[model samples]
Target chain A: DQQVKQNSPSLSVQEGRISILNCDYTNSMFDYFLWYKKYPAEGPTFLISISSIKDKNEDGRFTVFLNKSAKHLSLHIVPSQPGDSAVYFCAGTNNNAGNMLTFGGGTRLMVKP
Target chain B: GAGVSQSPRYKVAKRGRDVALRCDSISGHVTLYWYRQTLGQGSEVLTYSQSDAQRDKSGRPSGRFSAERPERSVSTLKIQRTEQGDSAVYLCASSPPPDRELAYEQYFGPGTRLTVT
Candidate 1:
C-alpha cells in the first residue's frame, strides 16, 4: 500500500505564473513533510518543508502548505522560471521512526518560457 | 564541504553475481541512510546508520541484501546472488544529528544504478 501519493503525474506552467503541486498521505503518524527537486541523473535536492504544527512555510519563490486535517499538502512556486522544470517529490516522516521518509511517486513539472 | 558521494555510478551484474556499492558521506555527518528507487517510483528506505551504529535495517528486502558502516563516514551496501528484481538506483544520503527544533534534511549522492542482466 502506498502511504503517500502524488495524484498528478505531470504539470506545465508558463513563466511568471504560479505552479502548484499537490500530495496526499494516508498515514496520520507523519508529522513532517518535505519537497525535493530532481534532475535527470542527479540526486534529489532538498527544497522547502513544513512541520505539521504550521499550515504554511515559504522560502524565496517556493511555498509549502500543509493541511493536516485533510492529510494533504501542496507546493507553490511563484513566477515560475524555465529552470524550475523538473520532477518534484513530496516525502513524509515520523521523527520517532528514525526519520525514515515515505515518498510520493513524483510530479514532473514543465515551466515554459 | 563536499556532498555525499557513491562509487561505481553504473554497474551491470549478471544474475547470481554479487555486487557491492559504496557511499561516502560528508565529513562530520553522524547519520547515513540507504534507499532504493525503482524506475517510475519513489525511494524506499533500505537501512540507516548513526555514528557507526546501525539504528534501523528493517527495510532490507531479504537475506541477499546487507549493509555495513565500519566507520562513521562511509558505508557499503552489498547484494548477494543478485536477481533481476534487484535492479534499481541505489541512493545514499546523510544528515546531521537529529534535533527536535530543526529539520534533519538528508543530503543525497548521485545514486549508483544497478542493472541485473
Candidate 2:
C-alpha cells in the first residue's frame, strides 16, 4: 500500500508566483517529513524538513506546513523561479522505523519564466 | 568531500542474466541504503545496512534480489535471472548514524538505470 501519496502528478506556475505542493500520509507513526527536489537523471537533493511537533517551518523562500490532525503537509515556494522547475518528492519517517523513508509518487512542477 | 557515487551509471541485461549494481557511500557514514524507482512507485527502499544485525532485506521483491555490504563504505546489489519487470532506476544513498530527536538525512547517488531486454 502507498502510505504516503501526492495526488497531483504535475503543476505549473508563473515566475514570481507562489507554488504550493501538497502531500498526504496514512501512517500515524510517521513523525518527521521532508521534501526533496530532483532533476532529470539526477538524484534528489534535500530541500526542507519539519518535525511533527511543529506546524510550520520556513527557510528562505521555501516553507513547509504540517497538520497532524489531518495527516497532511505541504511545501510552498514563493516567487518561484525557472530554476525551480523539477520533480518534487515528499517523504516521511519516524524513529521507530529504522530511518527508512517512505516516499510519495512525486509532483513535477514547471515554472514558466 | 564527495557525495555518494555509483558505477556504470547505466546497464543493459538480457532476460535470465545476472547483473550487479554497485554503490559507494560517503566515507565514515555508517548506513547505506538501496532503492528502486519505478514509474508509479517513485522510489521504494529495497534494503539497508544495519550495525548489529544482518542487513534488512524485507523490501526486496523476491529471492532473485540480494545485496552485500562487504565493507562499511561500499555495497552491491545483485539481481539473478533478471526479468523485464525488474527494469528500473536503482538508487543508492548513505547516511551517518541517526541521532534521537533528529531526522536521518541521506545523501543519494545519481542512480543506475538497468534495462532488461
The models' CA-based lDDT, in order, is 0.89, 0.88
DockQ of 1: 0.77
Docking class of 2: medium
For residues B83-113, write the lDDT of model 1, one tens digit per residue: 9998999999888877624546888899999
Cα lDDT tens digits for candidate 2, B1-24: 989999879999999999999998
Best by TM-score: 1
Q: What is the TM-score of each candidate against the true structure?
A: 0.96, 0.94
Write the residue-wise lDDT of candidate 1 on A6-59 in tens digits: 999999999999999999999999989999999999998899899989999999
